[model samples]
Target chain A: MTEELIIAGFGGQGVLSMGKILAYSGIMQDQEVSWMPSYGPEMRGGTANVTVIVSDERVSSPVLNEFDSAIILNQQSMDKFEEQVKPGGVLLYDPNGIINPPTRKDINIYTIEGSKLSREMGNTKTFNMIVFGAYLKIKPVVKLENVVLGLKKSLNERYHHLIPLNEDAIKMGQENVVSILEL
Target chain B: MAEVKLMKGNEAFAEAAIRVGADAYFGYPITPQSEVIEYLMTAQPHLTTGMVVLQAESEVAAINMVYGAAGAGKKVLTSSSSPGISLKLEGISYMAGAELPAVILNVVRGGPGLGTIQPSQADYFQAVKGGGHGDYKMLVLAPSSVQEMADFVEDAFDAAFKYRNPVMILSDGVIGQMMEKVIFKEQKDRWTEKELIEINGSWATTGKTPDRERNVITSLDLDSHKMELHNHKLQAKYKQMEEEEVRYEEFMCDDADYIMVAYGSSARIAQKTLNKARAKGIKVGLLRPITLFPYPTKVIHKYTERGVKGFLSVEMSAGQMVEDVRLAVNGKAKVEHFGRNGGIIPSPTEVLDALENQIIK
Candidate 1:
């Protein structure tokens, strides 16, 4: 079975980081994974996204055709990718960033007050972690311990200091989904 | 010679350049070819061996730096992918026009624009026929393996110096990324540069010395007779390189009925295709080119004469190698092509299927 996910938003909204966290978690679980971000000039203000595929075997291409699940952090991304999600796929979006975004009754949609929850958890940028927590609650691709390990592996010297805070944020996301959404 | 070590093609070029004591390396970053710089970054430049490394602002600047370094009587090298290489053409032509000696390593990727980053041999024409303007030829070397990438360093520099011309080591993403064992020869310098450009002293400007004016290295010859003589001299060097530097690898082709020709990463896959054909009891063999500019035309024609019925030229590009195969076959053997472009690498299974269509089916 293929577990494909696309995370999109404005460049600095932590969308790519969330996608990479999921991808690295996939890797930690011994699942085949591929992650590629749009690196062109349009990345600054335009929607930036990462396509991630996790599977049981070697992935043929790093590109995605139809996403099995997706997340959007900004209004533009939500509007752009609203219809791109596969039928019966899962979609998680930040409620604060989107207004009048179309709702699909056929697919599962989660509108989380991600930024608010992140601020409550002591970091405003941890909205991505909240969504990650939501996805993990619904589809546990890997264990919580494995996500930590994956994060550590992907961190470089420059970002090593942020690891503990990031882990706290991920735990907050995982816990917030349970207490708030009853997920 | 040294013991074999598994290496990727880009790293192989890096090792080879260092082995050749290249005075400097100037380049810009692009995929598939990025490993060239990555390797150099990991293996810092050692100045004592005459290595100077710099990451240029752009490919244009990189190649132009090559022009300057080469003019300084220093052996120099640079590398880039398809689009970046295209940007370097103006400087490349300038290098050619001025008859500068340097090695250009291109880890080719699919392209017309900023295409997908995949291995392909589509740049054969641009490289061999001269990517820049005017009637000139650069000695182009197409290496099929990491080993060849390493080995061709001497050949590349030697040929460049021999002809007072620029030489290129053209490889693709497959060759660049694929890891394989290689045997590196004891690093040797074939030509000692008296001065990067002054090595060939027909210069109108060098440095004003007592008894000598200056040595200016350029391609501008206003007088027709002078230009003709210069052209003849360059042509003579080309003829010499054709005789001495043309190289290729042949397999079980002597009594084979069908032939396949390819190079770089595609050639490696073609080898596997030949194996699959042989397993099916088909008398098929491969003619893999190691040198692209001075293409191995004679060797291919040899197979044609020995009752070879058909040939298939496979590549990542649409039909770059097809033209050369047709030239070699010269209507004697039926030729077909199978390929993909824009960074899509052709698979061995696909090539075997094509072989079946033309030869078996």
Candidate 2:
């Protein structure tokens, strides 16, 4: 199966890096993957997005229009990507920044208080990991073990000490995600 | 050394160049391709293999630096984006005229002037038809994926030296910016002084040997007859390349009714569209030109005889390669063009729709 995902948020929210980590995890599982970012000025301080495609077969187009899933971290990302999720697919979002939640009834929608949970953990930088936790819990595309290995490969050795905390954030997300639809 | 790693396309290109033991690299900074120079500078190949990496003042200066190094019998390269590459056209022409062997990487972006920083295949005509003055031809290699981005560096250099002319890696922003798993080549040692003297001694300006006649590397011939002979020599070399160096990939064309012709990033997108069209009970295939200059014209012509009904040339430009497709078809079948220029990448759905509306209709 091919999982085409779009992760979007403000530039500093680690949206691109999150997609990179996911792609690396897919690679670790011997899957063909591609990570393509919406680069240039949009990555400076504005909303940035990356398209990550992980497949059991060769990935054809790294750049895509619609996606099987959309991970929205902010309202702007939600406003743009809500309609892009394929029917009967998945939509995961952070409730903190979203004023109007997704209204798509055909797809499965889930919410995680990732920003608030990460803030409560006294580390706001772990916001994306928290969201990723919820995503894996819902979709479970790549194994959790592979995600940890991906972190080890993607992060510098100096940052390796914080892997446990990031893991904890992911667990917190997995435990806290509220599914809004069964479809 | 034959290791597998997930790397960005630009960084992989830089690493592959180092592994291939390139003697020198001169480049100016530009979006989507700046990572190439950055990675080379950070890796500092000079300390490892004595490979010199210098950031030139401008694209013109960078290409000229490559010309100078290539004249001295060193394997050299330079890279830039569309507008920056435009600035290097004069130097590129001079290198071709003088028969200097060099590799040029164009991580193409949208352009007619200073266009968007996004990906584009708009430079197809400029790259294959000669971007500068003179009736010259440079071997053009179009890489469709990050893996090809790395693999083509060595290929480009080899082709450049084989013909004693410049070669271009005609990549677009998508191949330059995307990240994917790549298997790197094993390291090769740089050429020794003895090897250089043996290989390039005949015409290289490597400080004229004492036992041989003084060699001069130049394209200038004042006499009309001699200049015409030089032109004929270049044309003959180009004809040889066309005969021997044409490279292409055909996917699902055994019983295809329609074919999509594309290169670089557009080719990747076309593959996806081909899959979609096949699922909808349409017999569509993809013909990707790996070498743009020595185009896959003969292969395309072969399809015409095999009952292929129509051809769709998809690009990131406003119908540049479509003309070539039309020529190859030679009135045997219909040929149509579909594209999204000015940095807008056409989606698979749009391409499929175009095939249904333009070609099938």
Candidate 3:
């Protein structure tokens, strides 16, 4: 099955990097992927978003209409993309950022206090990894080993020291996955 | 050996053009495509032996410099975004008329008047239909990946020389900024001393042509017949190119119940939409055209005979390639269109919905 997802937030939130990690994981899995982001001014805090599509076959479109899943890193993201998620879709929220939580029963909503968790993990930047972990527990697109490989492939060769802690963040997030769907 | 590295489309293009032995670069800075010049500035890009890089006064001056350099038979290139590309059209027309060889790159952005700086496929008609004046066509190459962005550098140069024309690499801002792993090939061929005859010899306008013959490269043939003859010659070249250069990617089209037609960055979007459609057992496939001018007409038409349902032309423009799709489909299958101009991208959901509403019906 092919999974199409969108990650949205303000600029400098590393939304694009999150997509990169997922896309890289897809590459390691031998799945076809295309990660596309808004260019120019959108990167300057004006509602940044990226769309990543992973499929068993060659991907056709980089745009998505009905998302199987989404990661809302901020309140703006939740407000904007709340209408687009498909029924039976997965919505992972950072509880510290989202102002209005979802009240949908047909879809799965996971609210993780990623900011606190990431800060405790020694680097708030690992918020992305925490969300990735939750997705791993629920969706499991890539094996843990392959994901580490993808991480090394994406991370800077100079900053290899941060790899171990990022791995811990993923593990922690995976264990705390929140399920908010009747189904 | 040319080492391969993961690079953005813009930087890779600059690297590729320089590697292909381009002797001169003339351009002004513009977003999305700004990295092209940015990379050039990092390391002075020169011809293998000797080349020149001139940051022109404006897009107009840049294209004119291209006109001058290419007229002299020197490998010259320039790049810009949609607004800048529009300014270069006049120079593009001049190049076409003078039978000059140059490579022009358009890192497309949303347009119509200083549109958004985002990636856009909206310039399809501007590149294909000759956005400039008079009767002419630019050999437009639409590259979807960083690899093609690199590989097409050589192809564009060769195509320019082979046809005595200007070639444009029409890329969107997304393609320009997106980074990917690329494997570079060994570059062994380069412009030899023999290739510099017209550029460095007595052929250029040095006022010395009067002794040999007037080296006038003008399209103002007052005689309609002579001008018609020239036009006829360009037509023949374009026809030959269409036969030899039509390139495209056909994905899962062997048994597709329906086909989607898209190009450049939009084709990538189409790929994602096809996957979603396929998961629902829709039997949808994609036809991604690489060469915008020498469009893969025959390959796209092949889908019609075997109950290929219909074609959905997804572009960033209103409906340029849609016309070509209709012509290729030839009433065998209905041709529909979906577009979002001014820098907006059509969501994959919207496209699938369009496909369901227009084609699957």
Chain B TM-score by candidate, in order shown:
0.92, 0.99, 0.93
Model 3 local distance difference test score: 0.81
Write down the DockQ of candidate 2: 0.86
The window of 10 residues in a row where model 2 chain B has the poorest summed lDDT is: B1-10
Clashing pairs in 2: none
Write down the DockQ of candidate 1.
0.04
Candidates' TM-scores? Answer: 0.65, 0.99, 0.84
Cα error, candidate 2, residue B71 (Å)? 0.3
Q: Which candidate is the best by lDDT?
A: 2
Q: List model 1 lDDT by residue over B228-318, tens digit each.
A: 8877877787777778888888877877898888877677667767776888898988887877867888888877788789998888787
Top-DockQ structure, candidate number: 2
Model 2, residue B284: distance off in Å is: 0.6
Q: Scoring each candidate complex against the real one, what DockQ results?
A: 0.04, 0.86, 0.39
TM-score ranking of the models = 2, 3, 1
Compose the digit string of candidate 3's lDDT tens values, residues A95-166: 785668877778888877778888887788888888888877878877888788778888889877888887
Tell me the interface RMSD of every candidate, in Å.
9.2, 0.8, 3.2
List runs of model 1 lying over 4 Å from the truth.
A1-183, B1-4, B47-50, B187-208, B211-213
Name the DockQ score for candidate 3.
0.39
